[model samples]
Target: MKDVYITRISKFLPNAPVGNDEMESILGQINGKPSRAKRVVLRNNGIKERYYAINSQGEITHTNAELTKEAITKLFDDSFTQNNMELLCCGTSSPDQLLPSHAVMVHGLLANKNLEVNSASGICCAGMSSLKFGFLSVKSENSNNAVCTGSERSSTRMMASMFNEEAESLSSLEDQPIIAFKKEFLRWMLSDGAGAMLLENKKNETGLSLKIDWMEAYSFAYELETCMYSGGEKQEDGSIKPWTEYSSKQWLEDSIFSVKQDVKILEEHVISKGVESLEMVFEKYSKDPSDIDYFLPHISSNYFAEKLKTGIKEKGLKIPESSWFTNLSSVGNVGSASIYLMLEELVHSGRLKKGDKILLSVPESGRFSYAYAHLTVC
Candidate 1:
């Protein structure tokens, strides 16, 4: 067994930025209004702009495979086309289809591009899971070199008319119960992007950018109880039902094929239970929040910033607000890619000094899971 070092990271964003006001033209009028729900969602989440895998016409432009390919391409050296990677791990909130995994699809595209990688590709739970998978594989000597990717095309595949759509005969969007509850909240929180990182067992001669120190993860699924989820449906026999079986109209009405979250539950769970789990991680690593030089967290809402700060203080750790860095306010919540995007922003800022220790926390509401890790610049 050997330790892992993340040597290189690359990322990609689709098309241009989509501003808050511009969404009305793409999503059309909702509840007989020009996407007032979008405006409200922005107010709640504090998202300025997000990238979509679509043009102004709202047509599908890039698939999950393409989004990931862009980042993966930047990771490898052009002259070194033959893959040195022994494993390919992909984490995606929205895969192009339900059949083949997104990792395998990306593998196929790599072959077409004359970039041959013969490693097995496997899909894991999105968010920190894919990155951790790479770390473990290299640590266990399963692969000397591995590439991990996280991508999200959540916006492009969303069910049509996802928000308030006021028919001349129907009720206004505000008056619609389900729209006011589910659709409005999630519509603005997500963006499309992809991030990839290359991990190796051996450190470079110049030394790696970040040497993996410690990694840990935990789940509070029982306490959260479906705080956030997206997928098809469940039948009476507890069997899974295909999302396509339902009409697009039913998708919105039933809250199917969408991210449904209870905000109060999610927030409470994160602040209370989430922090408790995080503290255990700190104890496991024998490090305090003050020992960390940089703190990067992937949070969907800016509102949680203070809550997390308060929680850290209560745990007897004294991390400063100025030490925090993230791209969420600008890039929006990029699902599984958020953690990688935040790390990318930090490394590119040129503020990091030698021996600086950084801590990253990525919490995915998919099942109330959290992963925290410590890394140091060499």
Candidate 2:
């Protein structure tokens, strides 16, 4: 099969950067008292700033479709938006709606701009799995050119609406703030962002391209279990409440992108799986640790930094501190949009030179999935 190259990548963050202090002010306090969730999350996650698609009143200002539209438009240069755009693959942790798929909605927006893509596909919550789909599409010759996007707009609305002191009445826990923060800490760590990459088959174009050397993905769900999940907990019979049977209040409690996670499982397994997967991918491509010129990682929390560094070294791959670059501390974890955003920052920073190899890792607690991609600048 011919190699796939990422010809161009464009990343976007809605509104301005929301600093930790400012975000705390916006989230306000729960139960009319000082809540330490925001402060502690900022300290532990190392997320100093993030973007939110919110209005002046701090309400959700952009839907998933609107965010996707802004991202697609920002990256759509006339030179690349030719009729050759054969496939569109959209990936996100949240969608504007369940029916009609987010990819189709993006396609509709593209069509309005006269950018007609023939086939559209998506994985609603697989994170980097969605971009891998587009990569495979072009590499497998199913499409000559493709566009893949990872967009997210999850914010504090859901977290505040469902976990406030009033809502805590539903729970029998004593420390409501701590319990609520534990359940939906993602509200602070996750922010709004969209990133898109244009992929094409081997070509002698005038644009820059990152040649794909090899890519691999794995799931450690067996060991990780459901560390992170959406929706309400399942009942005794293992059935979720149907939407039709939901009261407006119950609906808000269940349907939001408000995440439920097991912190112990995530901290224990995220880095181990990442190192194991990187080892396998490196061996598969005959790549040694010394050969990697750059390291791009999408980490879930800043708390895992030391563990990731030590764990990977323990596994025999040593990444230099200078070669490591990530936007997590500044942009926060935009979920699936993270890897592309990190790559975009690195690329535009003029740090990479020709022939330099980039080793990228994306770890997701959703089903505890991890993926590695080895790329070379052409």
Highest lDDT: give the candidate number. 1
Instruction: Single out the weakest 10-residue window by summed lDDT for candidate 1.
Output: 115-124
What digit string (tens of lDDT, one per residue) describes model 1 on residues 226-282?
Answer: 556566554445344666788877665665666666676676676776678778888
Compose the digit string of candidate 2's lDDT tens values, residues 106-175. 7776665343233222222344666677778788988887788888877744445555644455445455
TM-scores vs. true structure, each candidate: 0.87, 0.88
In model 2, how large is the Cα lDDT of residue 38? 64
**What TM-score number comes out for model 1?**
0.87
Reference-based TM-score, model 2: 0.88
Error of 2 at 204 (Å): 6.1
Model 1 alpha-carbon miss at residue 185, Å: 0.6
Error of 2 at 177 (Å): 6.7
lDDT of each: 0.73, 0.71
